[model samples]
Target: MSSPQPPPHSSPTQGAPPQLEQLFHSYGAKIYGLALRCGLAPKDAEDGVQEVFLKVQRRLGTFRGEAALSTWLYQVALNTLRDHRRRVVRQTRATEMSTLSPQAADPHFVAPGQSPVEQASVEERRQIVRLALDRLPHKFREVLILRELQGLSYRDVARILQIRQGTVESRIYRARERMAKELKKLGVEG
Candidate 1:
């Protein structure tokens, strides 16, 4: 079972409204992980953070506590990613497919606390794991990352994903097994 999260500023007597900055400060890492594993490239994930908050800023008053703030934020993030992906597809059609890559200017995905050499190794490993993760279908990938990487509970994941807990469990199991197989195919058996 998961530990209970205290409700955030549930009532007027509970305190002030949850600030956007505070939300970012508290949930930014989890949101970023969610975006990355949801199939956004690292660059798009960063941009998606801004877009997610913008939508939140616009629609916040409507939230009204029907669900946890985290659950609400996850929904917003997913929507924002979908919108961004759509825009990309449209632009690709308009521009007739430029071959230029955005990756050269994209910043590092993982933060490092060690020497450059160590950081490089860490980055390499992360890229490997991300590649394996990318090979999975989105449904399995989303469930696996939400539950495993972000440490959200089954109940939380089910609510955020709008799916049953049993589906989450089965998808997670398949995702893990598939990821392991992908890693092994790259000569990275563990």
Candidate 2:
């Protein structure tokens, strides 16, 4: 018998092996939208997307092709988002628990706009929206983001979040009620 041939190293681009560029092209917008809904700043969301793709690149060979490509991508994106959110929460808690204060103000606080009044109003609205979102429990907030912001179908949200469709619907309803209450407090009835 001829000498045993070693198994070929899987080439990165052979026959739909989930190339990094293709993955980004297909899922970039969804991942970014998810990151935004995760309450990350725009820059942080961008970085999260990049970091997610890096993980995808590293883990591509391990994908078994059992699920749809989109499903796998969403799973990766969700994991990355959770990791980033955990890091941010830890950092925030640490800062809140710290006594040391820097002399200089944080540059991230600067508002962008024309007049001070306009900027103030914009900032106020943003604050109100954020407060409303914060008032929601995690399950509710997630359903609202997936349904309203991300425009996911209830079925899709259920699938992605591993919840029953009825649960998704109920959580979304509760989230809307909580958001309305918060908005009413902010003098924005609707």
Best by TM-score: 2
Which digits, one per residue and each the tens of the lDDT, describe model 1 over residues 1-190? 9999898865657752469878888878777766665656666678777788878888888998988988998878876866775565477679987322223223455454677888677666666776676677777777877778778899988888898999888888888898899988876867
Task: Give the lDDT of residue 25 in candidate 1.
Answer: 82
Clashing pairs in 2: none
For model 1 the TM-score comes to: 0.65
lDDT digits (tens) for residues 39-70 of candidate 2: 77666678889889888888888888876677
Off by over 4 Å in 2: 1-18, 58-67, 96-119, 185-190
Q: How many backbone clashes does every candidate have?
A: 0, 0
* Reference-based lDDT, each prediction: 0.73, 0.73
Show where candidate 1 strays beyond 4 Å.
Answer: 1-22, 36-43, 82-123
Residue 38, candidate 2: C-alpha displacement in angstroms: 1.8
- TM-score of each model, paired residue for residue: 0.65, 0.69
